[model samples]
Target: MENTVDQNGLDEAIIVALGCNLSGAYTSREALLEAALEAFSSEGLAVVARSSWWTSAAWPDPAGPAYLNGVAVVQTSLDPAGTLAALHRIEARFGRARGELNASRTLDLDLIAHGRRVISDVVMAPHPRAHERLFVMGPLAEIAPDWRHPVSGETAAYLATAASIGRDARP
Candidate 1:
């Protein structure tokens, strides 16, 4: 998916997935998530549509705190890399720390896609692993059921049903 998208005439939708298992500074996971959504606008990202928070048991360790997850359709002027960087910044503001793989964190913001663009350069658009996780696809489907995968052209609803990971995910 290493390709360039023209930033000049960009009119495609931007999609992002949000997840969190720990509340960090916030008193509740939902509050942390809500604050993150607000931060998006501060960073110049406009959230056009958002899915309701979904819940799932911690993967590989169901005994851990359950996760709250959702997806957002955003409109931004920045390119894929810039968009990813903004997401990271927003995550960091919520105390997200990049450590072990899939470690529980305060915030997890993933750039699922930048319209139909397939970028594999500084950032990966149409996030490489999103399709495999129901936690990601399910919420995405809830908001945009007919959205097509940039590469496979599969509808978000179909992908959500076909996802193998996070089978316990629910809204």
Candidate 2:
């Protein structure tokens, strides 16, 4: 989240999913992640907690480089939109390109949740596709085992092991 806020906005906790397969302007995946965290911190988004990194096959079971994935919990005074904007900004700073769906990327930053707020604006919290991917659920479970999906009401732990593995697994 950014440091700005709405008149009615209060401090909120947010979950962010980070992943990288390709190296950006940064030298490597770790550097890209470090840069992203630095950017978040610069924006006043405090990283309260983060999951251990997990390696996973690229989506669609591609033969490309495996991606590093993790989850983070952040605290910020910024409203939902501001937080989302900050995330996009961070992604852009790392040279993320948007075009084809499911394309390989240098940095993928997804806002998984923003407190208990349910929003359906341009950015969707508690990402609709998050629960569908073991790569996401696996890391999310490591950091937020007790976290419940705002939409499906399933815990991250449950979703991580749901249907064993694979992106097509049911939660």
Candidate 3:
């Protein structure tokens, strides 16, 4: 679908994606990030805040190069599932191959939070793993430090700190 913004401003939401490998033909990390952002914006999502890409060692599997991760706060009318499906389509367009749970790929877009809405079917709410992943929490805390998890009731900043401590304790 062609990217277009509606006349009335839509509600805001935050989306996060990690650029781990240009597993496809694309070679630059910036290009991947731009494309992902454009895909979302094209769907009438307005980006409010963005975070700098953080380079991190691979997780779950370590064969691929370190990942470049960032987050974007967007305004959109689409429901949680709709927004997520849009992100999935964008990833597919960039040649993201989905298989194993934590395999590396060119694009990985996650619906971090959706305006306090908690959804559990097919698409999990508040991203079940958001608090535990440094790559996600770091950027999220940067943009919404005071934001509270709809379910856990913990502040983003707290979760981020916990994630950092968890990482340090790991081998």
The lDDT leader among the candidates is 1
Model 1 over residues 22-107: C-alpha lDDT tens digits? 99989999999999998999888988788889999998788889999998888889888889999999998889989998799999
lDDT at residue 106 of model 3 (Cα atoms): 86
Instruction: Count clashes in each candidate, considering only residues at least 3 apart in sequence or on different chains.
Output: 0, 1, 1
Q: Which parts of model 3 are misplaced by more than 4 Å?
A: 1-12, 164-171
The best-first sequence of candidates by lDDT reads: 1, 2, 3
What would you estimate as the lDDT of candidate 2?
Answer: 0.75
lDDT of each residue in 43-69, candidate 3, tens digit only: 767776776676677775556576777
Q: lDDT scores for all predictions? A: 0.87, 0.75, 0.69
Task: Give candidate 2's error at residue 127 in angstroms.
Answer: 0.6
- Model 3, position 148, has a per-residue lDDT of 73
TM-score of each: 0.92, 0.84, 0.83
Candidate 3 clash figure, as a count: 1
Better of 1 and 3 by TM-score: 1
Estimate, for each residue in 59-115, the C-alpha lDDT of model 2 and write its tens digit: 775686778787778888988788888988888888899998878898898988887
Question: How does model 2 score by TM-score?
Answer: 0.84
